[model samples]
Target chain A: MSPESEEMMWCHSCREEYDALDAGTCKECYEEASETEEELKREIEDLKSKVHFLRLSSPIESDLSPSDVSLHASSDRKGVYPPVPAHKIVLMSRSPVFRAMLGGEMEESRSGVIKIEDVSYNVLCSFVQYMYTADTLLNEQLACELLILAEKYQVKHLKFFCERFMTSRISNDNAVTNFAFAHRYNSKNLLESSLALILDNISTLTQREDYKDLVEKDPRLVVEIYEAYLSRQVNTAASVKELQNV
Target chain B: MSPESEEMMWCHSCREEYDALDAGTCKECYEEASETEEELKREIEDLKSKVHFLRLSSPIESDLSPSDVSLHASSDRKGVYPPVPAHKIVLMSRSPVFRAMLGGEMEESRSGVIKIEDVSYNVLCSFVQYMYTADTLLNEQLACELLILAEKYQVKHLKFFCERFMTSRISNDNAVTNFAFAHRYNSKNLLESSLALILDNISTLTQREDYKDLVEKDPRLVVEIYEAYLSRQVNTAASVKELQNV
Candidate 1:
């Protein structure tokens, strides 16, 4: 055989000729990997169908006959918006706060009217929809609002969902604000990531308007940020000194 | 280098040496495949969480304040079983049969009691539990019983679940019985597999008691099985003749 032929091997996957040095796996492993991929795909299909089966029709979308309770987003300036209809069982099942309020002899339980203070009408609707379906289309503003509500209701799943969305959207502009919000909400993951980003850009931290506001509104949070920055600096200095000694 | 070394290739996955013929994929493809597998796993995790979030507390398990409807499994030999508590909204959302029966002027709608005939209490509880959680532990008997109720209620997900279980458990001893059950229930996948298994064991068909019962009770099904066997034989003979001519 020629040198080229000796050096070349056919790829089982892409079916192209690749050099010996670029070889991936033995044929046995390739076949086994293919089988594993197939099994994973089948499992994905099964889980997808299970999700479809478990998803309840959002009460907001469907004309479900019995919505036992109604929720209003209380607004001081605009008065009360129309009630967002919901099932008590659904609310109770999803949130411990709702369960306590509805399961006990609370005013909300007796009147079948839940007054959710300081939430917008649209946000309230989305919240109720999520209770039924465990899904919602979210932007940054909506995610933050819903995160607060989820936190109050003790809906851990929705709170985590919102935190994930907000964390993904974090940037230099929002890192300080998000860090403060994360701290307030006990969002450890969001707090850590935002603090890391803030520390990375520590030179310009004092110049931003949000930074000044954070120092005024929550001076303790500002101190924590500085403490983290100082700790990182000490660790870096220690590493450099140890390297020099070596 | 030795000839042995010259003829060998390394598997990136298992880190083992093998011949050129045993080669699987190139390095690039292997890395890409690994990444793809990781992505698939992450997707599975996300989907599993979604399933968990969507799963509702079965009314049977929880002392939920309001259960709008109750179910009784009517048995001929035994007296009526205790009521299985459920929410109307859950029943309506899961099955169209329940939607029509409860949504309209049906007797079940007026009384808030649904009488499920020809089902045992254990099976009834399992059926309602699956309605809420989309899960159940099934033996062969339970699978068969739930499948019938699932079929009656037009709960396609549960029906498919039962069909998959029964299909996995099909054997020579039970093939004829399952074929009849699958046929009666319009289970195409189960019917096809059971029919194929029967055709594979055509010579022993008359020896089985279930086969004799099937011949006595549903002669048409027996005739259909024989027809399928003859069709397979003709196709086999045709393929043999083609090979001989070649």
Candidate 2:
């Protein structure tokens, strides 16, 4: 309850939400989450060490080409490949205690020669880094970059951050609306957070000039919010009428 | 490219499609875009000054009850009126940006008072602001909120943001895969952008984990991207296999 207390914590596995409570993993999925964390951490650390060693190797062999490492060709050697991305960054970043056990600096272990020209590769690296660490102060610019990276690699953790980072910045109305679009397909937990914001501010949100633009893109949000307040079964015709007034 | 170059503007309105150049609102829509921007700016500014002059006295005067404002009579005034949330910081901080454009704070506005808690009010206010302004940031958040809010109020922008922002984030492989979905759903420009991303980065993105996610979300993206590359030839099955191999 202190002002200096940490903000934002929760286990996606259990969907039990909390902000800054530190018992470490949620009680329900603690072992499963912990086991997964350890395995992935080991893998990430191993990967990072390889990458760092690769980078530290003098003359940084810039020779590896995308054309050379053809995934279609069975014989395309995997030794000097591009960077990797994963879905468990935010999940991994959840427990500082867990991360410390894994041996830090995950990006330091990667063992490939992924080109920066390949945006996907860079995104993967970023996700790996994000896995080991994340903080409020990380650059918004980097956050934006990592989001694109997350989406590119299909890294759910990075993608989650894309959503979470954006959510944390919801100090203004514009951000709320924009995020609504960005994380549209985000599964249940994220959807609920967004709903809380919109449902609670109906009158104010409804009256804005560009509100029509929002409506045009998605009339469903209006319908849903209307549904929230309607404790009684809403006749479709009357529902539409009430919505018109609301 | 020079970092000082102002010419390299990343116009969201224009560069809609991944490979396709920026072109969301057409050149013709420029007049409207400019007009809307100016009008919104002026309106918001005017409103802020008005609220400042009006100064509705109490930070927490008699709570504005949503039920009292409604035409329908209610016995349970408290049931109709939800207690305000503690984080309701909107009117208090008095964001100059909000004060200027929103005409009046939520309670002070024409709809009379609907007692939403502060954080919710701020969130809703942002959504409304986003709808009118087409502010990218707000829209993004609103898109996420729409799923929740849309289920309640029949608000369109929230849903619009949720869907459109996701579509708008399209670029490279993500766009390529997404456009394939967009094309399936009849999202024209979105399809265009997705195709562009795929077309441009098919070599790599086709091999991304999202490629698999896209396929899972809709096999159409896989087929359509194929069709896009090999238009109308109907050799999509072979191309799909090739992509699978990639």
Best by lDDT: 1
Per-prediction TM-score, chain A only?
A: 0.92, 0.38
Docking class of 1: medium
lDDT of each: 0.89, 0.42
Lowest-sum lDDT 10-residue window in model 2 chain A: A64-73
Residue-wise C-alpha lDDT for candidate 2, range A108-200, written one tens digit per residue: 213211223334433334444443232123456566666655554454544564666666665336534543555454434445565566556
Which residue segments of model 2 deviate by more than 4 Å?
A1-145, A148-152, A175-179, A229-246, B1-246
The candidate that wins on TM-score is 1
Worst 10-residue lDDT window for candidate 1 chain B reads: B73-82
Give DockQ for candidates 1 onward, in order.
0.71, 0.01
Clashes of each: 3, 79
